[model samples]
Target: MGRAIVATAALSALLAVCGCTVQGTDADGKHHLPVRIELPGAKASPSATASTPGTPSAAPAANVLWSRGDSGSGVRELQARLRQADWLFDGPTGTYDDLTEQAVAGFQGKRGLPKTGETDKVTWQRLVKMTHEPGKWDLYLMGGQPAGAPDPRCLTGRVLCIDKTTRTLRWMIDGRTVSTMSVRFGAQYTPTRDGVFHVYWKARNWVSTLYNSPMPYAMFFSGGQAVHYSYDFSARGYAGGSHGCVNVRDEAAIASLFAQVRTGDKVVVHR
Candidate 1:
């Protein structure tokens, strides 16, 4: 029994040196010693590896400065700059509309931008770099200038009080200004006659048989001179002059004025 104990102790010491542990006797009545092996410098398994925090991400969208349906002096400034670039042709109307949206998109596309039709910060910066600051008349190139005081001849009755110097037209009733807009007159050679007249005729959607051009919302005050909405005037703003009639650039304003005006309304065209 002493010798058997000595052998078992020797086996135990050997097993411990080998990093082995005896689990239990197998079916063969032999002790099963499983050795736990460890590598010198092995990498950790995927499951045993420690987890790390995720990396940060950038913003999903760019910063927007202006977009469709936005309006104010900012929009006017934008439009005026766009006009300088020849990307826009209408009023700085101080109201962002479809035309403004299209203009912005076109400008963005020309600059290799995302062309989202929204004026983003980067896009605005690029535009500012390419264009200069707009002047006062540039902002009001297509009208919206302040109207002048009504003449004494226009105060008493319903009158289309037009001031050549101010380049404005005021619709007045009983000495009260009802509505006002910007107006352009004929060229130097064919100047708009300054006189007190009456609207003798009105023709909606009229094509001038003499000039072969469209004269929408025409209110004839003289023989062939009328107050009318001119698409040319709207598109080219003060860059060109009319033949003999008064040209209105704002079509909507002129349309509204056309609806209110009637035959025999006083028309005072003055300097």
Candidate 2:
């Protein structure tokens, strides 16, 4: 009996080492040992599937209405309108490039539309109307001049109206308005004030000392108001909308305006 008990104890110890435990006996009076199976270095399944490194997860493709460079009258017309509206550059040369894509995205973002960078019917319609009639002002109100006002000079060679309402800067040569282009402005909290001012100074690729904003063509007009290029051209003029600075849309427009306007150019702002 003592030898039998020792043998049973030894068997139980061996089973424990092997991760096996004695369970309740079956109806046939046979002892059952349950095995605790384990896989070496096994990892549990993740709650979510791991995404591919550096690759964004699959997202539903945006509904594209217009193809890039679809040779058609409609496409050409849309491209032309976009160019005129300053939503695109170099007027629809029948070639779609990075500039065109960017302009489309900008237009879509401005109108509170989908930013698919595709010229759809809706986008086309908006561009056409906007380009045709850039400004919709019944009255152009000039702000009151402060005490000891200096003599206002008329630098009328090429006058550019940085419209606060349409978020566009229009160029007028010899009192004849030539072209207008869209522009971004300051935040809703801090906007470009309305008043008659002049281009006091010029700075190429000027960065703001107050904010993280980059002004490519800095044409200083008022105390802080200037005509400059901004990344946020999504807000095309609706209100007194700039950080006391008139913001233009693209680099091309900025360059053009800067080249035309010199130091002490007349910058008239009105309602």
Evaluate all candidate structures by whole-model CA lDDT and list the values in order.
Answer: 0.86, 0.60
- Provide TM-scores for the models: 0.60, 0.42
What is the overall TM-score of model 1 with all chains considered together? 0.60
For candidate 2, report its TM-score: 0.42
Deviation from native of the Cα of residue 210 in model 2, angstroms: 1.2
Candidate 2 deviant stretches above 4 angstroms: 1-158, 232-242
Candidate 1 structure quality by residue, lDDT tens digits, 1-34: 9999999989877765664545567899887754
What does the lDDT read for residue 144 in candidate 2?
11
Tens-place lDDT digits, model 2, residues 1-271 = 9999999889877765564436657899987854342234544233222345797645524445566655544554556667567665544444565677778989899989988787777877777677763222211111111112111321355555655544455666555566566554567787776666667889988888887678788988877767887655433323335576766655676687778777766665543
Error of 2 at 137 (Å): 17
RMSD of each: 17.5, 20.7
